[model samples]
Target: MNLTQKAMLGVSAVAMATALAGCGQTTTYPRTAPPTDSQCRDWEWDSKNGVYRCDDSSSSYYRNYYYGNSYYSSRSALQKSSSYSAYKSSITSKTSSGFGKGSSIGGG
Candidate 1:
């Protein structure tokens, strides 16, 4: 290829790399489990205080903050949590639950 074509190819490659780099970043958040303690051996979340229980060590310094890897310790905990129950009730309580229902406009 000629000089101009080579330059264009290089520019395209850089642009594609930059876009991919931006898209590759994953969300992160503080560990759901509590910090380590003198007697703790495993992460034991203390949902009530928004902290991990002092008796357990955290799994990691940070966790992937995404839908599939939720901070919850287990499925049972997630299902039993008030937020889960509330969300579940909201969807099942209504005949037209979940997206597709046009939003309502209000003037009050």
Candidate 2:
């Protein structure tokens, strides 16, 4: 190829690579310990009704578990957090990695 044509091809290749680098990227908010709350309750037997219940504690447990181990498309994406502490902690603990990006995480 001619010198001019080769230079153009190199530049185009670099531009293409840069454009696709962030594609398919995902940010991981790994599973972390649930926040401690004294209000949370445990299951209790209702002998009169013959059914076990504890103010929907079971529902909250599963919700927290699943929400804690969630992922986002990018670091800037919005997320639903259980509490301010969890949100703040995740800010520093989250990790992001993807194809075409360097191994150094959070490098941007």
Candidate 3:
């Protein structure tokens, strides 16, 4: 084969190799089962006061929920008491019951 053709083939092979390497790549979150300790984190989340919980995407993906809202984790302070559970229940009850058939904005 000519040098020019050989160089082109080399470039094409390198490109194909890189492309194939990326095909099997998968993103994985390392959270598994509920944390045993009062304070632990496995995935990205949001926290306020002493309350910690998974964000929107993580909530649906991991099924980490308390009441109706997604709660992946909580700080030691919240875990030390029952108040957090009560708070979660209140928030979930209110939000979940807010839905109605006409809630959807669009109509056919």
Checking candidate 3 for backbone clashes, the offending pairs are: none
TM-score of each: 0.27, 0.27, 0.27
Winning model by lDDT: 1
Per-residue error (Å), model 2, residue 11: 0.5
What clash count does candidate 2 reach? 0
Residues 15-48, candidate 2: write the lDDT tens digits.
6675465454444333334434433344433332
How many steric overlaps are in each model, in order?
Answer: 0, 0, 0
What is the overall TM-score of model 2 with all chains considered together? 0.27
lDDT of 3: 0.41
lDDT of 3 by residue, 1-108 (tens): 999999999997776665554433332222334333332234333233323344345334342433223343335544444665676555544533212311232211
Clash pairs detected, candidate 1? none
Model 3 lDDT-worst window of ten: 99-108
lDDT measured at residue 77 in model 1 versus the true structure, 0 to 100: 68
- How would you encode candidate 1's per-residue C-alpha lDDT over 1-108 as one tens digit per residue? 999999999997775554544433322223444443433455445333233433333534232111223445445665666765665455434523222222121110
Q: What TM-score, to 2 decimals, does candidate 1 have?
A: 0.27
Q: Worst ten-residue run, lDDT, model 2?
A: 63-72
The runs of at least 3 residues in candidate 2 whose Cα sits more than 4 Å from the true structure, single-residue gaps closed, are 26-108
